[model samples]
Target chain A: MKIHEYQSKRVFAKYGVPIPNGKIAIAPKEAYDIAKDLGGKVIVKSQVLVGGRGKAGGVKLAKTPEEAEELAAKILGMKIKGLTVRKVLIDEASNIKSEIYLGITNDREKRMPVMMVSAEGGVEIEEVARVSPEKILKVHINPLLGLQGYQIRDIAASIELPRKNWKEFGVIAKGLWDAYNGSDATLAEINPLIITEEETMLAVDGKMLIDDSALFRHHDLAEMRDLDTEAESETIAREHDLAYIQLDGEIGCMVNGAGLAMTTMDIVTLFGGTAANFLDIGGGANAKKVGAAFRIILSDSNVKAVLINIFGGITRCDEVAKGILEAIEEVKPKVPMVVRLVGTNAEEGRALLADADMITAETLAEAARKVVAVAKEA
Target chain B: MSILINKDTRLLVQGITGNEGLFHSQQMAAYGTNIVAGVTPGKGGEWVMDGKVPVFDSVKIAAEATGANTSVIFVPARFAADAIFEAADAGIELIVCITEGVPVKDMMRVRAYIDQLDTRLLGPNCPGILTPGVAKVGIIPGDIAIPGNVGAVSRSGTLTYEVLYALKQKGMGASTCVGIGGDPVNGTNFIDVLAMFEDDPATDKIVMLGEIGGTDEEKAAEFIATKMTKPVAAFIAGQTAPPGKRMGHAGAIIQSGSGKASDKIKALEKAGVRVAKHPEELPDLFG
Candidate 1:
């Protein structure tokens, strides 16, 4: 999960990383007041869950309070990468003597949480890693023996940092490690760890990505889940223990496994139909969950037809058939539905659904084609 | 001969008192895998069946008592890594993990710790292996597999079943099928299983299934191109998947401008492997 810049900075502060003082404001006037209180030039950054905000003109610097208000007004309702800016963070501007980069993330090759440091900063780190790959230094920290002294010294010398700044850099590195480890963050990054003219270090910008699988252990961080960024069907699907992703199309798809769900959607597209959403009822499905899944699919405004595909392995097709019948009783959907049941007890399940108003197909490809044709006619 | 498990395979079921453990243990035993013992921590000196499958408190005692060679885990994700550590410490040769949602960090540490040992771990969130008509380990349906010569490896569970069903419909059967789980980091990779399949003389053809995440497929493609002479056909799912969205599997996302279906397909085709456009199209290309 992606957190707002302000929230990430708050988490960073707890680890003794120096971040600029900032206040979140929902209105232009509030932004101006916060900037005025800071008593110097402040930066107003739009708070959204997407990247490339600066390129989208969601970031602005103001010399005076009135200018701050003007910039905030322009940014408040502005859309960056399809997300509306709900709030603006007004932070005290720091004087930058130089810029550097630091972050920790999992390296698939090493299967360890690797820390990366680079002297070139304030740009897309990916771009830097692509162009001048030699400038970046990476250290893979063993989770057993985390953030070792040798790793810190190795990275500092590799990046050619001045001897005086080595101590401060080490502190920031340790702080970032603690925040990342303590918060269950998949990614903890500071693109521009700036050294100011006052000879002090500050984390100029911050980004953190939390691990969803580890959310149950971090109760407080899970509370920070942003509902506005998610579709209603997605939120409801999670509540019902289903995996749902909204897509553009008329045929609504509900399938059993994650891989089969994607293949179902792909085949639908191959047959020239678009899926309204991708919903996987998951492994062990009962009548209640299946009924809930049907309701969620029907809730989509674009859906003209629904396709239910189940290749039951451990899951009995007859049990899924009961769920479909229960869903038909509850939703009574006006949209056309094409049901395909295969695998364990699939014969009994297909027999059970035979009396329903929905259409049935034996093969997955044939079922996908049937749904597209029904949707096109509708 | 099968690549992973066969008729002589002695099996130990971890977390055997749980629902999944009990159901799959019976299934494996019924499918002809030698069910030796079970481990449930506190259920030592107990029995799962009418003493057909004995229960031990730890894997060490179970290994010593039953002389079990391989173990399958069905524990919850919170304690899965510890279960792996326990089974490894007991010197289980091969470990198959069926639990999903294990934290990547925990697996990272687990992978590192297991590196120094002699154990090969399969899935933290995977369906176990099936040496068809001989031994069935985890959740893959044993009925669909008829025990022929084709070898299979995949990243998804039910989809693996779907592909096997498709092959079975065409009167083709598999020597062995392995589900390596769909996480970013795993213990055994495509290369590990592919090399085994290549060396097995019973296997005449190979079916490799991949999704749109990670460079595992690309690496496998390279291996297939330069190393193997066996007839290989491949299928990659998630062709219509949008960028930066994970399609249910934790490792199924297309992140950082990599792991696209088109790129993987292109690499495989260039490697001279017959790539199936759809799952149903795989049977025609298998020959």
Candidate 2:
């Protein structure tokens, strides 16, 4: 649900947040044109979903359009935090008077959205909160009342902004809040809300994470989802409504729920085997979905064995067993499978899988042990 | 003497005609829950569950007509908060919301609204609560839940079932198993449920299953250190989870100073609660 920085800035600009004029370029020529259009002296930033792009040398300052093209050429194919840079953002570089941190995120303890502001900016906010502790200002916003004028003023004052700049700060903070609400964002951040040489504020960098659940309501935002950062198996699993995350291990796990899936992975590790991936078939998954999950697991070349653990409540165990049997017919994967089925229709499910060439167990612990053993042997 | 529901409980199912609502309603009723009525907007005057349960158009009419004391919501995420609001407005005291993906913004409002009332809401993305052998609310598998003296509370649903099953392996069962939910802004929390279980006479020992993400577990550990004298066994999942990635559950993430598994485990251990290294080790941890 994380959008690229350029995309985030676009959304921010719509809410009247001042942003340096920027353009996303897929090639060096496009980047050159963007820098030229911005009168050169642009920052060439590699566009990737993952963080640490700057530390990874994916960001460079260009004095001219040719330098911008050269930096874009270098950054476009560079990998930052394991994600290959497919696009580079060419933005007008501005002189900064000062930087400040501004963000809105959910507070788990307060069970509400809290706006966080800090004098320290252009760096990790966590570092400021952890070390300085007193630098950051937090304001819990009521969902009904929203970010009030007083709340904004309080944040501005806490950040030690000059009285002359308070009104402009108020506008930027309000714009960020508006963008956050408009996009159904779980986290809206503008690190280094910079004061330009002209004393005007501009969100030089932006980050936004949209809520996946609320994506059904926001069609335009949903289309912005970057699939390149996602694992191939994960994308397919999402299509099947299964929760899947790729990992480095020998055992592939498919469980009924997310919590149980993680536990399954942990138990497999405890039994001396690493889980290749985390996969949950979700609630009430039928034969087709379960089969899809099985195929997704088998698709991972590193997976030496597979484990299917089902504690069928509303999700019938027999249906899961049927799905495995059906998937085995199609995929015909050579990897060993260890299944532990319990709960509703479990006996019937076990009976259905009895004649199959798979290993079955009665308890999750036993299933984990057996799968790890089978994997080690394989 | 369970913490939440018993045989005398009159249950109302919101979004009753919906797939999850109808399915769980049938399962719960079969397990001896006194499901009095169902509330599905505009599906009033109809009968469901083989015409045994009455359906109402609104939570207000449903509560008035059926005298239901407890309600479970199966509405979709978008409408779930309003469903909870309607249920609270109708004066239903005990509410369990099974809907997942409710916006945190909506839940904040829902949380504020519920705090003003006498009602105790369980989850917007939880498996609800179950008092085994008496009344089963929520979506935890009833058969795996053996009724006994151990009070179990968890943030994850299937992991809750896994622990209960493990406890069953040790010849232990639960007085009540409450899934306080894994959402950042759930209505009820571990500390709230821990307090309830601490006071419930039917509970002797307690089992707490937590995951990384929020500091709720650390808070609960603090509460256990101060308030409860009950023998507590704890297990935290996502120990090996990658940092900052949502581990299936929305709330199961490890961020800066947010609930980290190692921190929670250490806190629980220091608080005299036995922390299980692996889920299967729970039984031995208790021993």
Candidate 3:
């Protein structure tokens, strides 16, 4: 659910947060045109949904329009942490006098949204937390009461922000909070909320991660889903309302629950086999959903074998077994397949799958061992 | 004998007209849960399950009319927050929400609002509670669970079922099994349920199934060491999962180099809780 810096800035601007004038460019020519309009001096930031873009050389300053094109071309061609920079944000460069960190995120321990402020900025907040914990001041916002003026003042004073900027700082803080709650964002951050040469604050960089469950409400935000950042199988799984995470390995894991799916992956690794992906068909899955999940698992070329594990509670094992059989009949998969069915009519499920050309195990450990051996042989 | 529900638990089903609600309601009643009434807006005059359970327009009316003390919610994610609020306002003592995919922000408010009320909330995405052979609430399949003195708690549903099946294989049953749900923000935590288990006379040993995410497990470890007298065994899933990738569960992610399985296991082991290396090995640590 991570959005690019430009998209976050868009959300921030909508909430009255001060942000530098910027435009998105998918090409070097667009970057050149944007730079020319922005007074020929701008920052070309790669719009990938990852942190440490500057350290990874995905961020660069262009002194001229031509240089902007050159830097954009270089950044667009580069990959940071394996994600290709498909676009760049050409922003009006700021003469930053000082930088500060301001952000809002869920504090799991407090079970509330916490606003954090620090004198140190333009760097990873986690690093500041680890190295100098005292530098960061935090305030937990009650969901009912929201970010109060007193809390804002407490943050500003604790961070030693000057009185002249307090009013603007409060505005930015409230806007950040709005952007966070309004967009259903799990995190809304502005690193390097810069004090410019003019002494006015401007957000130089932004990051936002929207909550996946809340995407149903924010249809506009849901369209911001970047398919380029996801595996094709993952997108397909999401479409089917199944949870799937691609991984390296040969055994394609299709399980009932999330925790059990992960545990199945671990057990696969423990048995000297690796899982190609983690696929949870979810609870109460009927034959059709199970079939869809099975096909998604087989979509991966890395898969040498398929392991279907179901500890049915809400999900009936017989339906899962029927889906697997239907999937095998349709796909006619060449890879070896192993099935483990237990709980909630598992006997009927196993009986239904007994005639299939697949290995069966009564337990997860047995299934992992058999699947790994069969995959190695296959 | 159980921490949450027993024979005295008169249950009301919110969203009872829906598929998941009606289905689990029937399953729960078949398991000997006291069937009282149901709540589905605009369907007040109807009776479901062969006219045995009457339907009401709202939780307030359902609670007032049926004298139901507890409620299990099966509404969709969009209406789940309001459902919890309605159930809470109705003065239901214990509310178990079975709806998955509730927005975290809604839960934030729900959690805050419920904190003010004298009520105990369990999973919005969880399988709820199963007090073996007495009363079954939520979606935890009752047939697999047997009546015994062992207490079990988990942040997962089917994984906990796997552990329970493994325990049952060794002739071990549970006094009560609670799934706290897998969301980062939930109504209850390991410590809340663990404290109840520690105080319950029917419970002997405790088994906790946790995953990588928040420090709930670590804090529970500290609580187990400092507060509890009963022996505790635990398992932390997602050990092999890569960092920053959510392993199906919304809360099951290793973020900011924290919530790693190694860290949780190290803390739990240091606190003298026998941490299982694998799910199958969990029952061996029950002693």
Question: For every model in order, what is the number of clashing pairs?
Answer: 0, 0, 0
Q: Would you give me the overall lDDT of model 2?
A: 0.88
Q: Please, what are the lDDT tens digits per residue for candidate 3 over residues B1-287?
A: 89899999999999999998999999999999997999999999999999999999999999999899999999999999999999999899999998889989999999999999998899878999999999999999997878888899999999999998998898999999999999999999999999999999999999999998989999999999899999999988898898998888899999988899999999999999998878888888865
Index of the highest-DockQ prediction: 3
Those runs of model 1 whose alpha carbons end farther than 4 Å from true positions after fitting are: A27-33, A64-74
Predicted complex 2: CAPRI docking category: medium
Shift of residue A282 alpha carbon in model 1, Å: 1.2
Please give, for residues A1-378, the per-residue lDDT of candidate 3 as tens digits.
988899989999999999998899999999999999999999999988777899999889999999999999999968898888898999999999999999999998888999988899988899899999998899999998889999999888888888999999999999999999999899999998999989999999999999999999999899998887889889989999999999989999999899999899989999999989888899999999999998998888889999999998889999998988899899999998999999998999999999998888988889999999999998
Sliding window of 10 residues with minimal summed lDDT for model 1 chain B: B278-287
For candidate 2, what is the DockQ? 0.66
> Best by lDDT, which number?
3
State the DockQ of every prediction: 0.70, 0.66, 0.81
Candidate 1: docking tier: medium
Best by TM-score: 3
Clashes of 1: 0
Pick by lDDT: 2 or 3, better one: 3
Q: Tell me the lDDT of model 3 at A168.
A: 99
The 10 consecutive residues of candidate 3 chain A with the worst lDDT sum are A45-54
Candidate 3 CAPRI category: high
lDDT (Cα, tens digit) per residue for candidate 2, span B1-287: 99878877999999999988898998898889999999888899999999999999999998999899999999989999899999999999999999888877678888877898899999878898888888898888788868899999888888888788888878888999999887878888889988988899999999899888989888988999999989999988887777877888888888775678889999999899998877767867766
> What is the model-wide C-alpha lDDT for candidate 1?
0.89
Candidate 2 local lDDT, A209-295, one digit each (tens)? 998878988899999989998998888988888888899999999998777888888888888899998888888889999999999
* TM-score leaderboard ranking: 3, 2, 1
Candidate 2, A247: how far from true, in Å? 0.9
